[model samples]
Target: MSNRDYSMAFMDGGLGDKAKARYRKRRKALAKTVGMPYVIYGLDQGPGGGNPWDSHVPVIYQDPELLYLTGVNQLNTALLVDPITGADILFLAPHDAKKEFWEGKQLGVGTKAIEKLSKEITGFKDIRYIDDLNEAILEVLKASKKRSIGTFWHEATQGKKRVAQDSNYRFKKQLERLLAKERPSTKVVNIAPQAWDQRLVLDKEDIEDMREANHLTGYCFQDVLVAKKSLKTETDVAGYLNGQLQMRSPFGQSFPSIVAGGKNACVLHYTKNNDPLPKKGLLLLDFGLRWNHMHADISRTIPVSGIYSPLQRVLMDIVLKTQKAVQKATKPGATLDSLNTLAWDTLNGLLEKKVLAKGGLAKLEYETAPHRIGHLIGYQVHEGDPFRNYNDVALKPGMVISNEPGLYGYFELTINRHRYKEWIGIRIEDDLLITGRGCENLSIDIPKTPDEIELLMAALV
Candidate 1:
């Protein structure tokens, strides 16, 4: 762990007020729509025993909705909102002086400093210990004649078996069961969609934070690009970029750094940085830096040597052209489905012209480009909706998405008489912010063009 204290910066409370305001507005809207009296959101407690790896090194991940409502980053926290009265209550874990001696300072409830910090960071005046959580829920239920209670309950994407094994999910389910037993008449409803709708649009502060993350991530990427020649292995490059990010910010990489070389680039999300750089092949780096809970997803491919070969240049140009075309078509009101279609058409056009492949565009995309053109980026590396479904969701201002166009060819898969073989796996990813006029490339600072990448690498060599 980097010896940098991100606690202060993380608690600087950038979007706390705005997020609270938005939550208030959403509460009112939900009351009018569903007539729900109160909504409860639980934050994930720092990792516990179920997963051995997680238990060893607990990864603290706050629930996105709860984090939006209350800027509390600590573990074992919950948020309760009463739509009828516009009241917000935050529950905190009881402070243990002994635990603090071993661990760190825990945020104490009702303390003078805690009160001030809560008000500044969460915009909530009422802070109570975890012991009061049950009583507080009971009080809210009794006050509302309807006895209607709302809590987030969404099926785990990974499946019920996985959720059962998850400590956090199990904890949340226990809480839900407790609520059910406490008040049998309580009408429980899922508030996940309401929260998701609100989170879809990024506020001013959210956008600014994303921009800062993108800038910092771009800087680290530039360093890695320039140092490619000196980097002996993929892990070395990942370490260097990680160190650079830590030196500047208290947070770590948004996601696991992907430093794939040569054939490994064909596997999207290849996190095994143990691969060696080929004598002369492409190096695909897909990395991002997380700052202030915001993420910047970026990917760039460059030659292990200072210059791209003839075949590599041809494949890279196709991907770049597809990315440029998609970016040009991206704007407010543009549907992701249309943009994705444009990407497919642009890449397929090259294939038809015998520039990329002989055939098997669909098969190649299915195996390699399994992911969409891009996904919404923000608090999570992959946030909100993806680029699929026709005319489902239209792009709007304040929406940030990725514009990554890629092409991966395996050695077994013959593309142009297998001349290129596994030698080509190129993906050019850049964070894009949708605007009224057009989309702005947040990762533009990092070089993408063949000449630009070669020039930077040459300087370092």
Candidate 2:
């Protein structure tokens, strides 16, 4: 088990003050949308929530919306934004020095240095102990003429139908149940959808942050390629990438690294990096590293032995072509739903020519790689609202989204009058910037094509 100290990764990189200001404006905007005389409470997620405290302290992530809006990334804290007032409140636990000795320093109301920093950085009107939350909420509710309260309801993977299983959801339900028991007149509102839409348009600073993250992730990916020939197993590949990321980044991987070898790649979300390397097949790597709490997601499939087979090269071209088609389709005024449809149709069109069997597409999709086209990228890996939630929302400039479309399954077809059966997985993912005319692939410069991968590998090794 990792030491508790190493479990959490955080590096503000001096962007905290500016990010907080931008987020403050976002809260005010949400305030206007929900109207003044409203109270919105956002929670900091509890310690990774699972079985008990025997394991290392998990990453005590702040609710993405809470961190996005309030810039307070600490445990045991809750934010209450009073849109009607000049500044909202941040309630945290008072310091327990004995626990701090065991765990680590926490941002509490007791420590003078922490007190000053939290106030300066968060811009909250008041920072009180967590014990004051109920009284504070009561006061805000009484003053909230709208008779409503709000909180963000996304848990990063809310699209997976496990919405009720997360801390944020529990926070929402608790508020509802509490109000029903004592304050029946008040209504609980999910301000997440509106708050999420607000994040769709990234400011210049936010975009730059993402680009920097992509640039560093690209660097680490190159380093991974440099060591790829020596990587003898899937775990070796993942470990090498993790080491590279640690060398360059204070905060490491944004998501669990996927380093699947050969048929293991057929599993779209494959994360078991324990398999031995295949001498003659492809290795799929899908990983993202974080910078300043922003995430950069990129996936590339390369050969295990530093060169792609003839068949591997051909299938790769098809996936790349589908990706290019979808890239061209992404632009301002284009709906996400349409882009997704176009991607699948274009891919199926290309695949049908290669596979001559009834229901081939269904078999591949359902049995192998069944996933939505992409999603918005930001503070959290999955970020705000799922694609389906805002499927009809037109793509706009300043928005960053992913474009990942691929097919993975056993390929059984008649080629040259011979039976061809092999499990191949080819997925090329990139972070894209939605622009006025068309979108730009932020990770495009990272070598991906057969020629690009081969030449780079040869040069490095």
Counted clashes in each candidate structure: 0, 0
Model 1 gets an lDDT of 0.70
What does candidate 2 score on TM? 0.88
lDDT of each: 0.70, 0.74
Task: Write one digit per residue (lDDT tens) for candidate 2, span 127-236.
Answer: 88887776777777777655788776654445566544446677778778878886899888877777777877887777887888889989988998898878899989
Tens digits of lDDT, candidate 1, 164-243: 23333455566668667888777666565665566667877778888898898888878887677678888888889778
Superposition error at 320 for model 1 (Å): 0.7
Model 1 lDDT-worst window of ten = 1-10
Highest TM-score scorer: 2
Name every residue pair that clashes in candidate 1: none
